[model samples]
Target: MTSKSGRRVLVADDDEAVRRVVHRHLEDAGYRVESVPSGVEALARLRGAERPDALVTDLQMPGLDGLALLMEAKRLDPALPAIVITAHGSVETAVDAMRKGAYDYVEKPFHKDVLLLTIERALLHRMVLEENLRLTEALAREFSLGNLVGGCAAMQEVFRLAGRAAPTEAPILLLGESGTGKELLARALHYNSARAGKPFVTVNVAAIPESLVESELFGVVKGAFTGAVASRTGLFQQADGGTLFLDEIGEMRIDLQAKLLRTLESGDFRPVGSEREEHADVRIIAATNRDLGTAVEDGAFRRDLYHRIAVVVLRIPPLRDRIEDLPLLLRHFLGKLGAAGLEISSDAMKHLADWHWPGNVRELENELRRAILLRGSTGSIQPGDLSPEIQAGRPPRGRGDGRLDLRAIEIPDEGLNLSDLEREVISKALQKTGGNQTRAAALVGITRQTLIYRMEKHGLK
Candidate 1:
């Protein structure tokens, strides 16, 4: 076989003749080979300078056996694939080797071709594992608290609240629009908390039909109902000792809400068909864009459950309310798209900032991604590159009368978001009144305390 140079394989066996033959075969296969007399020597080499791509160790060694060596090798590099060379024809030993995470195994009298193939497979497995690690690390860094891009006061406060809530096991209620990144924040909370290494299961209450909501959350037994052929584990059990994020939780039926409340209060739930109660140690984090407070008052949601899941509430400001972060978010998306060097024209930036992002950050990201794909190799983005809705959102050619003309305001076909419109009007009122809170409150026909709360909610000065 032609040598595969630069690929290193470490061989550990007490037999000198075996080592010599194996070394010769690997070297001829274009691999750099290192032979060690025992598992201890192999470990020292692995820990010392260079690391091998794969290990070939004998099942029986003097000081450390092949199984022990494999465990240590995994501790050093979990991605490293190892092959066990077992001279013994014992099936138990082979099973033990496999149990200890052996990539592949060969008998002592194995053919050279078989050994070479096993080594090649091990190397390929290692490469895949390394690539997965790189991607996982990249994603972790991308969503890390420090890496989340936003400098506006509202965003800063959100970050602060998330940081404080991360280390605790309290249920967090995330309030925001559909595309406002509630799930991302839920993940951040999970990965930052003590449950970081545990499962982070999600259930979109709105997506599931009302009939299946309970079964999906609480699992089912064999013959639980029609089409129930086998016992099934529910999301609650799957998220045991971790986090369970219920998205659009307000859409859950009131009857299901009571069952969910029971789970939250006691961590106990019964499957749809089973009379026995099971326990799951899961931390709940519920999110919704609807006014859950109103839902509770309207008898659409259970009042007790509302208060139970909302141990720590975080209201994510809509994109329009925190428009100051638009530039940063645009740049963030550009960087994520591998277009960090691309610049947006001032007019384009203004257009992006001025438009009410009903879909919030998700929409912004999609727009940037679409823009990048559509405008290939373009040096920069201009106003015309934006969507028609964004372009038409700009205030029309003014009367030039210097006087404020509401008639010139151009509303898009999607119509104005009443919440956004109200926020902007209040903001403009505050701006026009030179930061006089009382006068601004009076002009908006709201109580001073109500105005103060709105200002704080919008993160306005």
Candidate 2:
């Protein structure tokens, strides 16, 4: 009765007869089965390189009893489902096992069909858990910090603090401007921690409706309110054993903030319309552009919660402060654009760096994207290709008098003739240099022969 799925099962029992019976039945039912004489051997087998698909063990095994083994096994592999085997009339202990997170339990002297059925259910659960983990990992890829770019002093400090805090279970508070990549830092912390393979959930407090914020954070039970037909788990439960990012925490209403504070303090929360409280094992990482200290003074944010979440605060510097990183950031974005043929001129780069980036890195990326498209076949971005505000912010171009002035040469709407302007500039340069082509060329930062050729072309006798 070998199982075609090639699923593996580990059975541990002190009684040789019981172990042989379970092993034979499971193997005949088309599963690869292994048996251990004691809970100690069962643990060793579970801790081995090849983990079984499911575990079944006796509750009263000598040394490292089934309950302790189940806990240790789950600690090693959270997704591994298990069934506890107990003597008949020991239903109390079986209930305790359930409280401790067992998938199911089978009474001793049970029929072979019953044991097989329990094992099947446990295996199905294990499959579901594995699929959930896979999907969570896929979603986490969106916020991965593997590609974060910056090497400035301010950003280096940020990375240092983030690296120091990632391995611990403490809640982290990220403070920064709107576009300073706070959420990105939070994801870095999660991926670098022990729970990297687990779910990483994000919730924007400002985005969700105030009325539904509680249910959204802690979940909702059926009949909780209007349109509540089915029970739903909240973000906290979904992010259990992983990280939960609370973006824009300062925007949460005061009342709802209190409930959040309780969860942060005790790791226990009650779903809407449910009397029972559930425990969540989630690491919280909250971020906000607003100053929570100001909000606390205004009675908008909870002080206790602030202290709880800000145990290790990391501040992300605004792009303006990290202007030295512009070149690196620019290269990073240009490479991402995949425009192998395009480059940026030095004047265009100066224009980019001079402007105060009120919108931060996000605006810079958007501007670069627009420039890449608008460049067309030009092959390089110039000062004129940038927005009018950016061009207006450029350093003043010098006048013929050798004085810097704000007044720039303006062309009429119909556009001035380029030949007329070039001829006028050459005649004036020759007059200023006493008709000497060398001094005139030096004045205009060009070679003497180029100046003579321009003079002849303009018919400047």
Candidate 3:
């Protein structure tokens, strides 16, 4: 017998001998057993603060019979597992108890081993239900809109639009640069909508080969093509009554776009090599980094198909466009990567904020992960810890006058340390003028005396 030392079981029967025998058997099997002489007492135990993990009760008790007791226990805690004990020939009563939510049934004149095994199975069922509920709640919190992490106006607008469109069934079109979190937003929409309990399926149009794209989306019957051995369910059926997110939708072949358009319009699709048309009520959310309007004009995409899926369009801004959210993004990624305690040096943060992230949020997360690894025993991140491309910051943009444009500098909403800014400006000016204090002061548009005073105040050479 497996050691069930911590599990509690409640035994209820009108026969005092049966209750005593069951209590002793379960205690011998390492269960913390509670014995009650009647069904009414079992119901009282279930309503107590310390409810039992599993209940084993007799079906033919005099008052408040086992069926009624089982129903009340379930009402108190729907996940509580119960086992019914019926007379040897009372199979119908046992089946009725099962239909009303008993986990399993044990016939009277039952072997002690059989009763113990039934209780074990019921406890196991309770455990599985608890675990599934835990996972579902975790996913709900992880995909909640409040977890998206954004403070910039552009990002806030994206959040607003997504919230407004999430509960609707209208097909959505997500347009953004690569790595701008189109798939993440799609998941948030699905998990927050009416179809949260159903599956949220995803397919990358650009990743699949052109030859298999059609079958991949609409499924294939056995022997539909060469090397076909069994039927395959496609994304549409898999995401039935939920969501189907197509990433990089612009990469789909023009010929296949017509078929996709037909399914979107009529909710009917035929599997390959099958004459019968199957229907799936799937909500489509398609994303693309490419400009579909331009693709339509260039004959690279079907204009009619484009019109079908663009019911609600969302444009996720790139990282460079929403640099104000960098601090929040950094904190979010750090917490997620289990490096929340690590600090970022001012110089390192400046480089991160200045870089024009071509790969957007995904790339930023990768860079931070790499920095944490390279930081070794250090508790903080420095510029040297980052990738060479990031450490270089953004390349300088020059004007016709050949002077750097200080006006273009982006100040984060939280602002910066004025002393740090002054020191950096003085140091750069001195470097440009080759350590000549007079020319450096002139370049900085400050008097030589004031520049020297400020340089001394900042402890700059």
Per-residue accuracy of model 2 over 1-461 as CA lDDT, tens digit each: 32337899999999999999999999898999889999899899988999998889899987889999999988988888889989989989998998888899999888999988888888877777777778757645654555678899888888888878988998999998767888778888898788888878999886777788899999999999998999999999999988899998876766777889999889999999999999999999999876677566645567898899999999888888899999888898888888655789999999999976766788788888888877655669988777777778733344122333538856689998888987888888889978976567556544343565567777887
Evaluation by lDDT, superior candidate among 2 and 3: 3
Provide the lDDT at 251 for model 2: 67
Task: Count residue pairs with overlapping backbones in model 3.
Answer: 0
> Which residue pairs show collisions in model 3?
none
lDDT of each: 0.83, 0.83, 0.86
Taking the tens digit of each residue's C-alpha lDDT, what string does model 1 give over 1-461?
A: 32367988999999999999999999998899999999999999889778988899998899988889999999998888899988756657977888879987898788999999999888887787777667656655665778777799988999999999988989999998768889999988887788765678999886786688888999999898888899999999999998999998876766787888889999999998999999999999999877777556546677899889999999998888888888889888998899899999888888888787767899899988877777645688887787777788843342121235679999999898977777897899889889876567546544344565567667777
Query: Backbone collision count in every prediction?
Result: 5, 5, 0
Stretches off by above 4 angstroms in model 3 are: 1-3, 13-24, 37-39, 58-65, 86-99, 107-111, 163-173, 190-200, 214-222, 230-244, 250-285, 292-313, 334-351, 372-386, 389-461
Show where candidate 1 strays beyond 4 Å: 1-5, 17-31, 86-121, 167-171, 190-203, 214-244, 254-285, 293-312, 330-461
TM-score of 1: 0.63
lDDT of 3: 0.86
Local error of candidate 2 at residue 149 (angstroms): 2.2
**Per-residue lDDT of candidate 3, residues 163-266 (tens digit):** 99999998999998878999999999998888877789999986787789988999999999996699999899999998999998877776788899999999
Residue 424 of candidate 3: its Cα lDDT?
97
Q: Residue 332 in model 3: shift from native, Å?
A: 3.4
Worst 10 residues of 2 by lDDT: 395-404
